[model samples]
Target: MSKVRTCPACADGAAAGDSFCEGCGRTLPSDIRDASVENPDSVPTAPQVSLSGATPGPEHDGRPGLVPEDGPPTAPQVSLSGARTSGPDTLATQPMRRDSVPSASGGPSPSTETARSGGRTATSAPTVPAWPPPATGSVPVKPTNPDLCSWCPGRVRTGFCESCGRLQPRGRDHVEVCAPGAVGVSDRGLRHRRNEDALGVRVLPADAPHAPGAVVAVVCDGVSSSPRSDEASRVTAEAGVTVLAERVRRGEDPRRATGAAMTEAARAVAAIADSPGSAPACTFVSAVVRPDTGAVTVGWVGDSRAYWLSGGPSASASALLTRDDSWSEAMVQMGMLSREEAMRSANAHALVAWMGADSGQIDAHVSTVTPTGPGAVVLCTDGLWNYYPEAVDLAAAVPGAGAAPREAARRYVDLALGAGGKDNITVVVIPVPGGGGPRAGQA
Candidate 1:
């Protein structure tokens, strides 16, 4: 009913009415709403030239002669840095203001924290309060046994591919992070060669005075089209989570902290590529639990999401807290397209917003939730969510909200891989610590 407003390759953070890529001037993909399931948004009117001098073929899906899948494993990888091709202004070259203002909550003043990344020295200040801290004496992550050979499912013993006969350059391409109450896993999955998705988690010391033991989880999916997107996604996730978590540590307002972090993340990602037109980008989503008040905060760009799996001892209840900034998600929310119809459309998965220099001036979409019972907050990239779009379905497939955070994260990754690992998979699970929770087998 309306002009297509999302970009499949850019899939997570494009603004609602943007007509072209902010990083690149390429025309954005359009959303077509009809029983045909094709994307008119992706249909190009101009002909592209072939190397052999043949007439440019008609475009299909997101782009002609490109993989039909708009996001990674298909073509999402290419647009991670800039949309489509060598368009004129692929990135913003001007300097970005520091998103991290000095903590006003009786912590450091603005003069100390302003834009430290561009090479400024800050006078050391007393440690501000951080939401609960990492668990005391938690064992160092196991160097062996936790990760299987990414190719053959064999234990990556000895840090070599000896048992599986597969050459694993990065040793299973998996990363696991843990804190006092949360654990997250990032995997390359079965399909993609490189794991472009990245995860970050930070927990307060169990004895933290402010929001003791609270945890923050951040997940980002690299735009595959850009060069060295893996690096970009990793940087974005780390920078975003670090800024927010540190802000909380300093007792900053959670909502404002989230906004500041998104700005920090965008700047960090934009700086990843110095060469003009090759800046890398990624989608971002985060979950934070404030145990003292039983509240959960979620912030996101693009489609990466956060879900509250709360309920029983029954543990069957769940709800999606983040609204995807994707084409079809917007259409359904706006009542412009039916849910079933939008999900089935070829352009349904295109991003409406994301993180990167190319994403251009984005405000992180944020929301809060108070669970009725004890549970966990699950934050993940599209690689896992695309397989289980509905919260109920995701809750059903994952371990009950009461399960240990590490196990829960591992289970979700297993579920996605089993359901057909189409892309890189990343999941972070943060358990709600104070309320009554479900028993082990409740779900």
Candidate 2:
């Protein structure tokens, strides 16, 4: 008979929100039950690779996606992996997991795992293919209309009627979203003058209670240096989530769906640029996970990130998925600078590419991973990740799947604030349903 999940420390059935194992009093991954941020030793999981296809390496299905106008990247390429994991944050010192990751000489072998006995619903390709323009029809969230002041029937502003200065309604500078399978929260943070980050989450419509499509999560970070960057993030996230979710619902291939959706996100942002030269830009990172396969497809531009958090008797593994499109990453790839040197440089965190009007064609990177156990797919802007530099630290600080996802997101934002919130913080938490599958033989 199949057994329930047991704590790794005590072999006791796992309970919700307990910081320690019930039997042995051991620490646990936050969000497993309550708020969590316990740090574990991080395993470095990125290998330096080179993709030679027109666009670079791995395509959506692990083939080359787009043909780069500049030929191949002058720097060493970090191709997407079909295996499950987050890219190493401390890439230089991180050791490669043993999985015979493909090398520069060969194109990666990607997979197309359709939804079991039904229509398909994924949103990534192993290697990105050429991205076409975004298709139309935007989904708008319900609009909010201010309530009239009880005493003065005037517009409300900061809890006071604009006309009478009478207290009206309380408001928040941030946005909150809650869904059945996922939750997200965006905050301006203590340090930032305004919240410039945006997030979106959706659980795809399932054919039945037992079979669901997948969850789509997107988090975008506005470039502080650019004007109206926050607006850029908002439109990009909203449009991306709508199109991507609906596409999957229609049974499109995940690789094709995600690539087209991200491109559409770019176009949506570009429309706001008034002129191509002064376009506002933001970093985008998103993920789509199928409940049945524990399969994940990830896509991104710039440095926002995604993470897999797994623990317990199933004890699959946890990892960071997407790598940053920053100068340091490029330098590290080119062998022109070591990880330390690249990180220490003033431009280490500066993004090399982003979605904006002036920005040229974006060659988005996509990768897939199927964890054979229970976990959460985390998407966040740099605001949160910057504070937790190491994956171990991030794993500790992030709340686990046990906590309500929206609450977990808020708690994560709180963590960034506690760490001297340096920028806008946005977090989107996606719970991967179904835990404890057959052990994945090797990574």
TM-score, one value per model: 0.62, 0.62
Candidate number with greatest TM-score = 1
Candidate lDDT (C-alpha), each: 0.55, 0.55
Q: lDDT tens string, model 1, 1-443?
A: 22323346644223333333433324445431112322223211111111111222231111111111112110111123333331113212221211110011110011111112112222222121232322421111322344654344356655444574443435325566655567777766654545677777777655666666667778888765455567777788879888988887777766667777877887788887655455666888877677766666677777777776653433324556666656665566456767667655555556656677666554456665455446678988876787776665676676564467777777777777676665677888877753542222221
228-344: candidate 2 lDDT, tens digit per residue: 666778788877877777777777766567777887898899889867545667888888777765567778878888776653335334556666777677668768788776665
Q: Could you tell me the lDDT of residue 108 within candidate 2?
A: 11
- Residue 269 local lDDT, model 1: 87
Runs off by more than 4 Å, candidate 2:
1-172, 208-213, 436-443
The weakest ten consecutive residues by lDDT in model 1 span: 99-108
